[model samples]
Target: MSKDFYTQFILPYAGIIIKICRAYTDSEEDFQDYYQEVCLQLWKSRENFKGDSKWSTWVYRISLNVSLSLLKKDKKVNKKSVELPNLDAGAPQDPNPFNDESLKLLYLAIKELSELDRAIILLYLEENSYQEIAEIMGLSPNNIGVKITRIKKKLKTLLDGKIY
Candidate 1:
C-alpha cells in the first residue's frame, strides 16, 4: 500500500487489525507475524475492495482471513498447543491498551472457540450490527443472531469453568 493510503485508511483501522491478530495468536512473536501478514494482505487485496461495505468491515474480513489461514498452516505443521502468555503475570506495567487481566483471560477463552465462532464474537465485540456482520460473514441476519446467542453461552461456559 502507498504511504498515503496506509496513513489515511489502514493506520486508522490498525487497532481492529491488531485485536484480530491478538485473538488468533498465542505468543508475542506470533502476534507480530500475524499483524504484519494482515497488513500485507490488506495492501495486496486493496484492488479487490469494491466498496460494497464500509472500509472497516472490509479490513475486518481481511484480518480474520489472514489470521485463520496462518493458524491452519501452523496447526498442520506443528499439531501442538501453543500457550498464550499470561499478561497478568507480567514483568512490568506500561501504557499498552490491551494489558488488562480480565481482557486477557477473555481473549484466552475466545482462542478456545471454533474459527467461525471466534470471528463472530470478535465482530460482536466490535459493536457491529447483526445485519452488518451477516453481510461481512455471508450469513443471514437471523443466523448471525442465533449464532451470537450460542457463542455467548459457550463463552460463558468457558468462563465459568464448565468448559474450556
Candidate 2:
C-alpha cells in the first residue's frame, strides 16, 4: 500500500515537492532533508485526505507546510547566517531543474520574503488560480489576490526592479 501510494501520488507530484523544498532550504543537504520530510508527512497523512481539494492542491499544501515547519525548527536549533547564492558560479551544486541565473535570482529573492508571502508567490508561480491558492492556503480569494499583488511587488523590489 505504501509503495502504491508513493508511485501513484508522491511520484506524480515530485516537482511540487522539489520546488517548495528548494525555496525553503539553503543547501543541498537541507534541500534533501526538506524533500524527505515532506514526502514522509504526506505518506503518514495519506489516510487523512478527504478529496475536498484536488490531489495536486493537497500536495502543495502539505509540501509548503512541511517546509515551513522544518525551516522554523532549524532556525530555533541553530542560528546560522544565510549565504546568498553566487549567481556567477554557474550551475548550483545541487541537482536543480531551475539552474538558470534568472530563476536562481528569483528563488534567492523569494527566500528573503516572509514565510506566508513565499508560499503565496510559489503557489501563484505554479499557476494556481487565486481561488485554488486560497483553498490550499486557507485564505479568502480576495485576500489571495491582494497578497499576490503585494508579494510580486516585494519580489520585484528584492530583484532590483527586475520583474521575474
Candidate 3:
C-alpha cells in the first residue's frame, strides 16, 4: 500500500481495530499495548493484501489472531486453577439506566463471550450483516445466525437484573 493509501484507507479503520483490542483487554495500558501490536501486524500483512478481500477483512483477521495470542498468554500467566470461562460468559448483569459505570458492566458482560462470539456481537452491534460477520469469523451465515442467537440469550442472562 502506498503511504497515501495507508494514511487514507487504513488509518480510518483504526477505530474498529481499537474497539476490538479494547474488547479483549480491560485496562487502558493493556489496550494500548494490544492496539499497537495489532497495528504492527496490519502493517506487516499489508503487503500481502491482494485486494482480493476488503482491507478491513485483512486487518480484522490479523487483529483477531493477535488478540487470541494475547489471551492465551493471559491464561498461562493466571494458571488454570478454576478455568476462566470467556468474560462475556459468567459476567454480571447490566444495571438499569446505563451510565459509564453500567457501560463498564456491559463490557464485562461482553468479555464473557468466546472470542468468536465477541467478534460476532461486536460486528453485529456495529451493523455488520451475518454474511459479513461470517466472512470475518470463517463460518457460514446460517451458523453465524445460530451462534448469535445463543450469544444474545447468554448476554441477556448475564446482564439482566445486575446492578452496576
Candidate 4:
C-alpha cells in the first residue's frame, strides 16, 4: 500500500481500529494480528467504497467484521499462552479511562458477551448514536436501543452489579 494512503486514511482512524481490535482479541499477539488484518482489509476495500456511508462508519464495519472473522479462526486452533510486554509500560501517566480499575472490570465483563453483543457494546461505549450504530450494524435503530439495554444488564450482572 502507498504511504499516502496509510498516512491519510489509516492514521486518522488508528484509534478506532485499535479499540475494535483490542476489544476482540485476548492477548497482545492476537491484537497485533487483528489490527494488521483490519488495515489490510481496509486498503483492499477502498476502491469498493461507493459514498453510501460516512468513511468512519465504513472503518467501523470493516474493523468489526475482520475482528470477528479472525476471532473465529483463532478459536479453531489450540492456543498457547504468550506473555506480552505491559501495554502501558513506557506511556505517560494520564487520566485515561482505561487506567481505571472499574473500566477494566467492565471490559472483563464485556468479553463474556456474545461476539455481536460485544460489537454493539463497543459501538455504544464509543457514543455512536443508535441510528449510526444501526446503520453500521445492519439493524434497526429500535433494535439497537433494545440490544444496548440488554447488553448493559448483562454487564451489570457479570460485574455483580457493582459497576454498571
Q: Candidates ranked by TM-score, best first?
A: 4, 2, 1, 3
In model 3, the Cα lDDT at residue 13 comes to 82
Q: Flag regions of model 3 displaced more than 4 Å.
A: 1-6, 79-102
Q: How far is 134's C-alpha from truth in model 4 (Å)?
A: 0.8
Greater TM-score among 2 and 3 belongs to: 2
Kindly list the per-residue Cα lDDT of model 4 for residues 29-55, writing each as its tens digit. Answer: 777778788889999999999989988
What C-alpha lDDT do the candidate models reach, one value each? Answer: 0.82, 0.82, 0.73, 0.82
Candidate 4: residue 127 Cα off by (Å): 0.9
Instruction: Using TM-score, give the best candidate's number.
Output: 4
lDDT of 3 by residue, 5-85 (tens): 657755778767766776787665566667778777777776788987687877778878898798789778973232222
lDDT of 4: 0.82
Stretches of model 2 off by over 4 angstroms after superposition: 79-96, 161-164
Each model's backbone clash number: 0, 0, 10, 0
Return the TM-score for each candidate structure: 0.87, 0.87, 0.79, 0.88
- lDDT by residue (42-159, candidate 1, tens digit) is 8999889999889999999999899999999988898444776433432222246456666767888898899999999999998999998998788999999999999999889888
Flag clash pairs in model 4: none
TM-score of 2: 0.87
